[model samples]
Target: MEATYCAGVLSRGKLPVSNLRKSDHGFQRLTSQRKAIASVSCHLSNGLGESSCKSHGFHGGSYHGGAVGKGKDPILQTRCSAGVSMYGESFLESHSHATEDKIGVLLLNLGGPETLHDVQPFLFNLFADPDIIRLPRLFRFLQWPLAKLISVLRAPKSKEGYAAIGGGSPLRKITDEQAHALKMALEAKNMPVNIYVGMRYWYPFTEEAVQQIKRDKITRLVVLPLYPQFSISTTGSSIRVLQNIFREDACLSRLPVAIIQSWYQREGYVRSMADLIAKELERFPKPEEVMVFFSAHGVPVSYVEDAGDPYKDQMEECIYLIMQELKARGINNDHTLAYQSRVGPVQWLKPYTDEVLVELGQRGVKSLLAVPVSFVSEHIETLEEIDIEYKELALESGIKNWGRVPALNCTSSFITDLADAVIEALPSAKAMTNSEGTSEEMDNDPLRYLVKMFFGSVLAFILLLSPKMVLAFRNHLF
Candidate 1:
């Protein structure tokens, strides 16, 4: 599933653009070479967003990826850069009687196709997202067209993987259960807030959830991305969508909102993860000797080194914390971390999961346990990729026994912790209005953006037109 998801739906290559203003360029479709160019461009990294996404709020820099500036106003990356700022120095006192208000907890996640038929459109949505694929400004107008082309081509393989994993993605069903569980958990705490699931790519899209928030007259809102760790590609993407929507709607614009940027550092989450890993380790003959392999989803290295994405940093720290919990419980074991589900034409976070499994097997590791640290629910990447593909590779390479730690779908402790996070963020519930000085980082320098777009267009033109590149593209998809 990891290989297919990336090679099919998320398969993208970066290219440059040309003569790029904010206008549509043309009606040029070369069918004779369409397959070649599309397939090749689908996986190669044109590195277009490298400049636009620079700093991503790192170092001594106050701004982070799509987020409000750090320090006193540290908040989610919101591009809601319009209207008057209604918030004050501290949002905790900005609104009184929040307890009496109708509170809504929005859980943002990555959506998946529910059935084989939904694959194409889901792929289209995934690729159409500039946050996901990062197209050049010159080719910005081609976003939809490019999305359609790639989705149609990749649908066959994507559907096959979905079919293998029971003909669809269980992400929706699991996410819904999580929402139900979170609601119940919050209610148990005597702080009941309506829980809504907003998937980034598929059904129950964030836009749909926003509309419901309007209809339900929800007063206080808390955005809790299902992602335990923050990443511009995940939490930032969803928040940006909310930022865009909230910026336009008057009622939403003024709504009191608090966003839990990340919760991996939370104690409950760390304990829950340790618990899962410990239990899974017991399945092996010598639990103490079992190799604890953590396979996390991968992102382009540029997202970290260049864009200042904290995903790798947070992931490492999360692992450390979880390991500390395990050690405290007297369950210390050999462990390693690797990245999976890489896409595009660039380098992703290394050591690739596949290569690591082979290396471990060659090292004569007999018993191994795979822990999916980044994901909280069982999805294709877990059910198919790690469980099936990696497991098979492990046995063939040399290892004999293998087991995977289950996702914290509705684990009691995890849910309860999530509830606590929402309650804790209420005091800081901020309205994403312009006066907060949060949206400036999102725009960057307009001149720099334009120049990047121009160069991007030129590079894209050259890449798609090259003969060798065309052949490589054809071999990738066709």
Candidate 2:
């Protein structure tokens, strides 16, 4: 549980020799403390021709080794020495550089089909991920084959969906604008930072961002998954992919990275969303007599029950929190949560957004406000799916007014809220100890240790029971 330390600088595209320090002698003697610990220094080369070397001591004796690169030169070089201390008063100092002390913000997002031609391939990429499908290893092979077959059958119909709005998904364009707006907002605050977009399912993937980070020689990274509400199927999957890639690539693994797992409960976020809703309500003839419908992208029900993904719960919490904010602002009327854009015949979380609109229309709800709560930027889901498709549905159902709250793309308030969320989520930026003893010390704290143990046990039990649960549920439902 002790904090690990590594000190080295890049040299000739490889990690150069560095020194390690032991400072445990200053600590009070304890039975748990062990002496004569060994440490090893290793160099990691990200496949993208970048090398980073790190050195840390373990209980066993330390050793040194070099890694061979596939191309022009050796990728990483490392040397190990015992009883050498490179302790710094501040842990952040170890990673900080004089030239660039700015925080690096990476926006993690899901990229959709860019053009009409890209729609089928984009969906195929999304369905191909094992994390998303959650099928058995053998069945996974069957799943992708089946997915491709279904894609062929669904492409024509899906293409029509794309054509309804335009010939492409608006995700990439909206995301780019969001990134630029965020950058300007941070600059206005004089917060030294660079914002980069890393997509999960399409162009500008996470791997590409990792490579770019290496190329930029960024010292600290703050990864912000764009989902306001987190779920294992989305944010969790992205984090796992990043973790695995970091584990395999040495250069990326060595960099200091912190993830903002979820910010659904952030005050600024909830307030900004409430503000959007409040402004939209003004356009309606009867602001007080409107039904507010929160439409979130739907995932399979099995993912919620079997995988223990907190998406639905988190989404519901978000709606509740936003409603509370609206009430506090004296703008409350009536609101409902519904799931949207469900694919496949399998039942998704309901009431379906479109279906809800129809039923509301039938019930004489003349004016309705549709809010896409899951997504931050306007994409096909908002512009095409909700605006075009759902608009027609509402008209067909004899509802006179159907308006969607604009997506939070590049809005000043939204960008400011995003920056506030990031700053609030991060630990204090002030300098602190870089001693390995601190990690050990914190681990020994009863409260911290208990929480870790509790979560670990719960996760283990869930995994053990997941397969049977998934099978049973699928058998009964499908």
Best by lDDT: 1
Q: Model 2 off-target regions past 4 Å?
A: 1-102, 428-478
Q: Name the TM-score of candidate 2.
A: 0.69
Q: What is the C-alpha lDDT profile of model 1 across 323-360, one tens digit per residue?
A: 76787789878788888887545567777888888998
Model 2 poorest 10 in a row by lDDT: 1-10
What residue runs in model 1 are displaced by over 4 Å at the alpha carbon?
A: 1-97, 435-461, 471-478
What is the clash count for each candidate, in the order shown?
A: 24, 7
The number of clashing residue pairs in model 1 is: 24
How close is each model in CA RMSD to the real structure?
15.2, 17.3
